[model samples]
Target chain A: MREVILKTTQLSKRYGNFTALDNADMTVYRGDIYGLIGRNGAGKTTVMKIVTGLTEQSSGEYEIFGKTGKAAENEKRKIGCLIENPAFFGNLTAYQNLRYYCYQKGITDLKQIEEALKLVQLSDVGNKKFRKFSLGMKQRLGIAFAVMDNPDLIILDEPINGLDPIGISELRDTFRRLNAERGITIVISSHILSELYAVATRFLIIDNGKVLKEVTKQELDLECSRCIVLKTNDTKRAATLIENKLNISDYKVIDSGEIRIYDESAKPDEIGRTLIQNDVTVSGIFESGVSLEDYFKQLVGEAQS
Target chain B: MINIIRSDFYRIFRGIAVYIAIGIMLLAIGVSIYMIQPGYIGNASVGDINNENFKTSNYDEVMSEYTLDELRAMSLSDYRQVMLKVTGYELDRDILGTNINLYYVFIFAAALAVTVDFSGSSIKNTLTSAISRRKYFLSKLIFVNLMCLIFLFANTYIMYFANIIFNTKQFSSDISEITKITVMQIPPVLALAAVLTGIAFITRKTAVFNTVAIPLIMVFQLILNIVAAALSVQEEYLHYELQLMLAKLANNPTESYMINAYLICGGIIVLFYTAGWLSFRKAEIK
Candidate 1:
């Protein structure tokens, strides 16, 4: 079994009458670039906060490096987090802010600060005050802070929020490098599914404070693979024809007029001919792959239903 | 814990607010020294002069009996004596009164120090580190007390040097007595700092803490005085108020009032610190 860097078992969080997170279970393994996918107010941040000790779970427990209760504090020191907005002293420069935290963390080697800034490509602007930094720079600085201590686990919530395309790509490369070279387990959440899809090895889909599904890169790739989309007047008949006639069981009837065939070997021409032969009026037939966004939507749709 | 304290001190010194507070304090001291001229002293002594029945007619006769040179020498000696009584270290009991308003500055400093972590959301970073909540709370408590003590000593020395420069008279109290008086004033200030810091941490907003804490301190002092009056405690023994206790301690350092002052202020510090720490430990950072 891979070393589990962090695990939450039936975790729940409630604020007053509102249940922010409900019976959520999550697992992040060492060296895994885990992507957390959710819509706004989907309890993504709540989970990250609980893991980082910014907030407490209402029920259940989470273990860091297989430690629970007070012992987890020591485990937390190995985790770096940037939940929500990156918080720092606006009056201090990026270097100063990082230095202050370094002091707090008792990191005497100042070289780490320089290296972190350099990694974020912020070495040139290290002396610029945080208040004067652009939104993109601030986000980069936040990432730098998270990765500065060379933490075993880095938990980032929407770390790419304000980055430009180039900045995002740079950060993506940085994330990949950290996970590949340094063996850092990264848990990142972002609405930009394309970017997340590029780096995440595993995906956790959550909706309404509950974990909808957990998918590995292989599973997600299979789900997002090129598939024949069949639109017929009778999707039930089309689905049956694709399954019985084409011997393709990996198919779903999305609606009365739509059927999605996930069989990579099933040809669109054959699928359309089979639907026609089955006396179903074929409207549209084409091959397409699911985007991460579409996959997330489907997961949430399933959870809601 | 040491790292937290060191970081807090670094942040405090780097920020502009602490310097602003210190500047305001020094300015207040400078203005007070400049305002305490001979004319004001003479006016202040008028009531005492009348109470003593030292008629103005006697001054005219004395002036006539002495030559101009003799009169000048005599007037200089009298001026020195009055200045000694008014501005000497022994006269420093009123130092607290002249600088009591500076308590607001100290309150601002304490509030800023405690609330910076929340205002900037830096506490999240600190909490996520290896430090525990208990250590953070203890570090803040130590930081506040250390700052209060430093300010107390700074104010005491400023008043001492100001007196020496302006009055040009020998101090009635020795350095040891003056040091004791200054040291006795610290407990109440530390108690006040504790309460303000507690309010800052509990509210986690400097504006709210200031708005609530300043009026709270004033009203608390008022209520204590009202209760003391209702109980018909002798005015001399009514060191229940912090200012009163500080003044009484400064004037009579060896008195029982000093012990009572320390006990009451020390108790307040403990209560506020405990509440602050508990609230901080449980506070959920967003």
Candidate 2:
């Protein structure tokens, strides 16, 4: 088994009468580009903040590299993060800002600063003050800071928010390269599912401060596989019929009285006919595949209901 | 912790505010030196030859009643010194020697040093680094105090240079005495800077710090004066108060009084620094 880089057990956070996170549990393993998926106010940033030590969890325990409480400071040193907007001194140049952190981290070699700048494609604009940089440049510089320390794990919250398409693509490549070449575990949260789909090795779906599901990329891919979706009065019976009569057991019963048959060889018309013959009231039947976005929405919708 | 301190120093020196503050302080010192003149005349009896305007006042006033002939007979340096004393430069000892504007300069420096982290949201980066919160807060406190000391020394140097350039008759006090008085001023000035730093950390806005700290210092001085007056405290004991200690150090340098000022100012620095650190450690970075 790969080592678990980060784990939180029943983490919770509250603000006065308002509860921001409720019994949230999450896990990230070594060398996994973990994607955190959630809508607005879904406790995504809260989780990242708590992990990065930016915010305190009201009640619960988190372990970084199996170290809990204060001992995690050492573990935290091996982790880097860019939570929310990238914070930097507007008066200092990009190189100066990164150099400041480098000194803080005790990395005396100036070459690392140059390397980080080059990695983020900020070498050319290293002398420009942060206040003068555009939003995209700021975001890229933030990435440079995160990766500069060569941390074992990098947690980014909406890291690509203001990037243009080209910038986003380049950052995606950067993430993939870091993960693959350095064997670094990455925890990233973004609303752009398709972009996330391109890089994430695993997905954690959250809603209302609760973890709805955690699935690996292979499992999610299988979940999103081409399949025939059938809405019937009784999905359990429909599933049984499809398994018994059609000799197909690869199917899942989703919420809203729907069954998705993953048997690629089985046609939707044949499945529909078989359901009807088995006295199953087939209200709707269609051939479709779930995108990550659709799957996230469905999971959240089910949790709400 | 050392690395964090180094980083803070880098950020501080690279920024223009600190340099600007130092420049303003130097300019203020230059202006004060150019404006001040020594008290030249000793206690001389002018009762026999004074005009009617001299009748209402004493010996100090008798010198002010000099006739045109007497004024013309006086040397240029003596004339300038008398004029300076008459214009209340005697009470302006603090302004001329101790760099009176340093109090405000410290206020500005402390606020700029601390609040820039907040306004830029750069504290998040620092806190998230390998350094602990305690170390970060300690570094800031040390940085503010160190900057205050540097400004104090700079002001003192300028004052010495000004004295050498303008006071051709030589200063009444020796270099060692001047150094002792200058050193005594540090504790109170540092204590004040620490308090302002605490306020800046709590408010995290330069404007807010200025608005709150200025009035608060004035009110504190007022309250101290009222209490001193009510208690019928001796003029010497009043030097033990916060702002008065600095002023007293400038006007009246005494070993016993310096000891008391040190004790009080040292206590205040400790109290304010502890409070500031606690608040900073507990504060939620948004």
Candidate 3:
């Protein structure tokens, strides 16, 4: 089994008359680019804050790196985070600010700061004061700070909120590269499902302070993949006919009455004729697919409604 | 915690606030070296100046005609003779005053160094990654007090030596007495540091800290004076005030009074430190 990097069980947070997070549960395994998809004020940042120790959970518990409570706190040194905003001393340069954190985190060498800035495409402006930075620059610096420590796990909240398209694409590649090359596990949150779908290996969708769904990349791909779905009870005969007559092998048999063909070469009319000729009742047949955005809205909209 | 402190200092030195604070202090020291005269002291000892003596017939005339600078420019014996004729007494415990005013500098510096983190939201970066809330609070508390003490001693000794070099031996008191008064001011100064740090955590805003810090001691003394006066007790309650304690400490306070002040300040330090930490322990960083 893969190592569990972060696991939250029934974690909740409340502020006075409002509930920010309610009995939310999530788990991220090592080397997984876990994407937390939620709309604004949907408890995505709340979960990140609680796990990163920016705020305490009102109830329930969470474990990081297989440890809970105080031990979990000690384990936090191996994690990096950028929650809510990129807060740094305005007067200090980006390099100076990261160097300060390097000291705080007990990092002896400073070259890592340069490499982090370079990864975020911020090396040219590393000497510029933070207050003088543009919003996109600030976001890049925040990302740099989160990755500079070479942490085991990274938790980022709306990290691409202000980046332009090119910056976003570059950072996406950076995250993917870090996860692939360095084996750094990351849990990134965003309301933009399309952007997240491009990078995340696993997903957790939350809305209205509750977790709505969790799905792996393969499951999401299968759900979202465009295909022709056929319903038939005679699974044995239908499979033989489809292979021999239709020459469509890119398919998955979901159950006794459903078989989905992923290859575009399998025409609906040909499959229907072939199945009917073989005395296999084709009860239902049509194209079926859903975009990631539609699916996220459906989940969040259902919760809101 | 030490790492946090190291980073904090790194940030501080790179900023302009600490240097500006030091500049203001040095300017105040320079101005204080010359502008402060017997007339500015306002101590009860000034009441001892007999108005009828020759060469000081008009008490205001001699002070206005010869500034302390001009008087000190004269030979030592000549300077002492003129001062004895004008005030009818020598320098007393008043000139070697407590460094209570230095506490204000520390407050402003603490506001910049420590409180700015909360106001600017940079605290999120630190607490979210570098350390736990407990260590954050501890490092800040220790940093504020340690920085305060360092500035406090450095300013006091600088002003102490400056006073001796420029004002002549007759005007400057003994080094041992000046050291005693400076040491005696510690409990109160450190107590103020803890209280300011507590206020920073509780309020978590620069404007609020400044609004409270700028007028803190004066307000405390004013309230004490009002209570003492309203109760028809001849201002007895004013003795516990921060400025009042400062004024008293410089004037050779009694041993029992020193002990009582130490105990009270000790209680204040503990109360504020624990209160600041507890208040900060669970604060939701937004």
Comparing 2 and 3 on lDDT, the stronger one: 3
The superposed Cα distance between candidate 1 and the true structure at residue A216, in angstroms, equals 1.2
Model 1 ranges off by over 4 Å: A228-263, A267-289, B36-89, B96-102, B226-237
Sequence-dependent TM-score of model 3: 0.86
Q: Compare candidates 2 and 3 on TM-score and give the better one.
A: 3
Q: Model 3: residues >4 Å from true position, as ranges?
A: A228-285, B38-98, B233-236
lDDT of each: 0.77, 0.77, 0.80
TM-score of structure candidate 2: 0.85
lDDT of 3 by residue, B242-286 (tens): 555666666657888888878888888899888888888888887
> What digit string (tens of lDDT, one per residue) describes model 2 on residues A1-305?
88989999999989899888999888899999999888878889999878777778999989999889889877888887888889898889999999889888898888988888898899998467999999999999888888887889998989999999999999999999999999889999987788888889998888788999999988898778898889997988887888889999888888758888888798988988988887899999998888777888888888889
Leading candidate by TM-score: 3
Best by lDDT: 3
CAPRI class of candidate 3: medium
**Lowest summed lDDT window (length 10), candidate 2 chain B:** B40-49
lDDT of 3 by residue, A174-251 (tens): 999999999999999999989999999999999889999999999888878899999999887888888888888888
A best-first ranking of the candidates according to their DockQ comes to 3, 1, 2
Clashes of 3: 0
Residue A209 in model 1: lDDT:
92
Per-candidate clash tally = 0, 0, 0
Give residue A193's lDDT in candidate 1 (0 to 100).
80
